[model samples]
Target: MTVVDVPGSKSLTARALFLAAAADGVSTLRRPLASEDTEGFAAGLTALGYRVERTPERWSVQGSPAGPPHDTAEVYCRDGATTARFLPTLTAAGHGTYRFDASAQMRRRPVAPLTRALRALGVDVRHEESEGHHPLTVTADGVRGGELALDAGESSQYLTALLLLGPLTRDGLRITVTRLVSAPYVGITIAMMRAFGVTVSRENTSRGEVFSVPPGGYRAADYAIEPDASTASYFFAAAALTGHETTVPGLGRGALQGDLRFVDVLERMGARVRVDDDRTTVSGTGTLRGITVGMRDVSDTMPTLAAIAPYASGPVRIEDVGNTRVKECDRLAACAENLRALGVSVTTGEDWIEVSPGTPRPARIATRADHRIAMSFAVASLRTPGITFDDPGCVRKTFPAFHEVFARTRAAWGLAAAASPDR
Candidate 1:
């Protein structure tokens, strides 16, 4: 199959915004993905009184390394949880009264852990509606940052929010995390921070983890975003479903994305995985064998992996993904419900999900308005003829050209033409 170069990592986009907002001068970011999520983040920065210039290939953000806007203002983060989560911590470090509002999907995501952590750090953060959720009003009259404890079981973004803003606090900060999930994402944040010239010291403890950042500004450098490994998971699954070899280029050997572990998942499913410095090729063995996997470290690939599990020879049980329930949608439940609709034998718990192989059934898969769910089911459709997806455009939150890329990949692999559904 033809090699596809996916867009920039969403993880990198969020971290870049955090670094850019903390930089002294204009920081030019090249190849920033222009998806809805990144757009919302850029808009949030603008609302915070930063000048962000978006171009075809790059975005130049004129930063204020000192802090956020001093005046009181309302910033609407729309459906981007990254913006909604990260911006408040930055605002808390500055002297301002800020109001944050988000779309219905974003409002559904949990934010209480972050709010509580910010409050513990002596920031005045109040929930305007449905306490612990979004529509928040934060007043940063002053920030006392020393030692703060956080419950990050719901999202790593909460820890990342505090970590990114910790350097700007008066006393810097040390964050003690309790029950941290998505640990790999924390590694990504730390790596990106180092790239921006910020040093964060982390220590793993029995209670959970501790992170420390020294008070400093970010260094502006010409940085290039790597291809999204999370997005590549769908194509890797497609190879397994269609028994075709799919090569994805630009996901280098030195790629910093933790989602690269998705390749190992494919290998376990009987797909041949070839890796080089610049490309990853997944060739299917014409049949898949199921294996139980603990997904706590690579939880982001669970949806895509589960979508392909129904085609395996045995049961595929995915565990250690309790945090998926709190994502954009109840991903564990959504995966079970959608798979069941397609006539697959599926079971789900609060945290774990299991899928059994069965005859393919043609059905219209519901995406639940989650980008990964939409793309994962699309890859599943490659095996089940007549399978359709409802509201496929939901992928725009991360991969806007997903449908086009899928079509191109299908043509290259000699698969039948599939028409895009109207959102």
Candidate 2:
């Protein structure tokens, strides 16, 4: 048995930071993720004059309801795509001239959809050199939000940025989502917004979904973030790979994060799962059977599932994951490449990947500096030997102590196995 305590949700931490900064008073975030991406977001907010303090147990953010205190600031968003996209919207809502830059990796991602939508809302967004990329400037006298239409085909963070900024606008906002890529993330955004005391009405329309947010700003409140289910997936997959039981505490049926649904996919794949109010436990039934799944909503776990595909009883087909191509790396291609490197038969199309059972061989996986890739392949290493990673340090993006915790879990499981008389 290996019981692990996964850290807080990165998605919820990012959203909490944005909402807390725009709030009326001091907000305390309990058990928030302390990672490069999340810490980078907090630092960016601090540069805009929000007081974010991190203690051992929690983080306290002093709100700036009247908008960011600085009139001119240069903020650096590292590899965190959520920070890069969401920070610009937060800057546009303030009365300032903010310049945003990113790391070499974040520089390649798409920011045009967000900037285009902001321009429609009457904000001046300019790209310094490359258009639709990072290293841009935003001149804001405060957003005059009205009915706005935008495409979130590339990433769901675009819609989340607007939804977070909705209540702060002069006339509120009526957001008609043209095309939503990752729809379930919007649900997390909506749930977080409501927790901070704002209501956003989402209705299905002929076009897509229209979100209506009221004109009142956010209210500061003490928030407890759920464990990162995306990070927890590796451990659950480990349990499914080995005939053992693994429990991730602080996550269950009431989790606010969308990635928790990954457990449901595992259950469908022949793993026994127990979900209560406090924890989620996964027990392997000695063998895994593959299943077809649409990962648009919980696509972050695609690589993790793909890692386990070769060990399963059948083929695993993942669909509706075109957005995986534009993430930290070309995740779909990366998964296929890594799977093939391990001698697994993998097939990939524009938005789907099907992996079949094969004898996993020794291979050094190229992580492409993507945290999910590093972690996913690491999970595969538990079942098969000689699975090395090109960039193991990339796990620092979300879980800095991931390898350390994983080793401890492995040691605990080894001890359990050695002590078992049946073994």
Candidate 3:
């Protein structure tokens, strides 16, 4: 068996930074992910006059319950949607003029719903250029939260931003979500908020599901982040495709991230999956079975499944991932294009993709500068040699050492299989 240690969760790391900043006292984050997106979030905190200390394995932040110390600040969010959306919302509870911008690609993504919701709460939000895009400013005088409605069909980051802002408000916030995608991500936010000393309430109303966040702010503590489950999908899928057993620790039955459920998809593909309290293992059964799955909540792993679909016995159909259209790139289109380059038959709808079984040919995959694109296709390279990435270093957005770690893990799997080929 090949045991792998993945980095801490990016979703958790970003939320931890925000919670640590909003808490009543000092907060320490252990095992937080060190990547371009997360590091940029920390940098945004620092620009807002929050004291954030970083180390090799741990990060500490001094909270300011009153909001940002600086009255005026300019923050540049690299490629992280969390930083672009959440940071500005975090600033809305303070007294300041905070201007937030992002990368060219991030600016193209949607931020209107979050900003509109912020405006309805009596905050002043000004768009620098596009009405619903980034390069925006938030003029804050504190928030008196109240009943509001939002649409989260395009992205869940908008809802997460407001949920994080609830405790910082005067009366708290009660949000009615009309259309939601990636519901599990909101669960992660509420869970992390509870960790920082706040509990958000949820209920199904006639209008929609209402989330009630109470005021009193967050309390600081030493928080430990879990391993990123989305990043683990590639390794688990690689094992399933190559008929090797691989184990990733820190993502177990109690793991908070929703992407860990990708193991269930592997099990459907004829892999033996063992889920324990502290770890989960995936061992290939020497066969790959194609499956049709709805990925509304676990859409991040869609590409991972798509990359390995060609090896399955039947057609693999992934549905309910329309939000993927506005992600780092058009993921459905990217998957279909890459699969075709490998000589596999594939079809894509607005929100669904069906990949047929075939012998994948070696080809250069265009990553579109998206990290998931590169990591997913890397698993296909395990069986189909000569597969290369157009942009290999794009994995830095999440896992900086992905190539190094994956290479070592791949080598260990080879040795393990050679030692016991019959197993």
Candidate 4:
């Protein structure tokens, strides 16, 4: 079997970019992902008056914590919601007016929570289009941080934005989040903030609680990004569904990604899981049992697990994942609809999804333009006889080399390209 190394974590990349842009001195990031999302973040930093130099393996960003360009400039974030959400807060820390816009897909993504939080922090933010959405004009006078509550159930990007900007506020920020979903991603944010010399504390006593960010700027340090565990989930699922052993290197025992728990889910489904200091190995036991679990924290892996659920002997039910509705697509509906299209019995809800294992049916899977959907379904194709993805290129947003990785790994299972009709 041909082994492949996944790219750097997108979550880490975005946080690193923000930290590098806000730090006092020149900061270098090693093995930074150069996908569309990350490039958009770099571009946003440039528009905000930070000097960014990019190479194949590293990025050097010169910080301008002072603020955006001399003249008010417009920043286009394309389809990267991380850039659209976080850059506005950074821009608000500086002088001058900044207009932020994004692609239609990103524009449809909710920004109200973050905008409202920024307004509450004393920044002048106006929604140029629909209320609580993008096309924003932000004029930064200053910030007066205090107690604020944000509903970030839709997207964790809002909480991440507030956390990144909190240290810059005068009184340090006390953010209270209600109905907080995607808690794992918030963990990534907090860890990255700590690495950059910012302190944040979270209370677990109640669903609605406060987070405190100490008033200070980020410290420059040499940081290496861990391999993406979300991308590794597809490969682990491929191994589980196809009865092949797949070992993804670079994600060690104490990796930062919450999606790393997906390997444990696969193990519960009758796969063998091995974790080492620098790699994780998943080997199928040739049979999978159905599992019912609450995936609120690890919701990003729902599509990967759902894709492989058809290979199990019973039904797999995933719950506590209502936040998937606001992702690039309605992931619950996409999983149910695509699994049904493949002739599998499926049921879906506003927050949860269920899939019953059944005989494989050859079909063209629609990814709904979501990267995770494309990667997860492509992994599913390894076992399902004639599955093909309608738009396989959708994986470029995260793992640009996903198809190549699959081709290299397919040989271990005696698989070959099946004359893709969709291509």
Q: For model 1, state the Cα shift of residue 106 in Å.
A: 1.0
Residues 168-272, model 2: lDDT tens digits: 898999989888877788999999999999999989899778999998899998999888999999999988888789999999888877788888888998899
lDDT of 4 by residue, 1-423 (tens): 336688999889999999888887888999988887888899888876778998989999887656555448889998888888899898877888999999888888888888888888889999988987789999986576888898988878899988988877777888888867878898899998898899799885464878989877777878888888998898888888877788888887878888999998988999999999988999888899998988988898999999988889999999988888888888899888889999999988878888998986878888888898888888878777688877888787887787877777786567876545247
Q: State the lDDT at 213 in candidate 3.
A: 97
Model 3 pairs in collision: none
Give the worst 10-residue stretch by lDDT in candidate 2: 414-423
RMSD of each: 1.4, 3.5, 3.5, 1.6
Tell how far residue 261 is off in model 3, in angstroms: 0.6
Query: What is the TM-score of candidate 1?
Result: 0.97
Q: Give Cα distance to truth, residue 85, candidate 2, Å.
A: 0.7
Error of 3 at 149 (Å): 0.5
Residue 147 CA error for candidate 3 (Å)?
Answer: 0.6
Number of residue pairs clashing in candidate 1, backbone atoms closer than 3 angstroms, sequence gap of 3 or more or interchain: 0
Q: What local lDDT does model 1 show for residue 94?
A: 75
- What TM-score would each prediction reach against the true structure? 0.97, 0.97, 0.97, 0.96
On residues 222-249, what C-alpha lDDT tens digit does candidate 1 reach at each position?
Answer: 6777788999989988987788988888
Minimum summed lDDT over a 10-residue window in model 1 is located at: 414-423
Residue 338 alpha-carbon offset, candidate 4, angstroms? 1.0
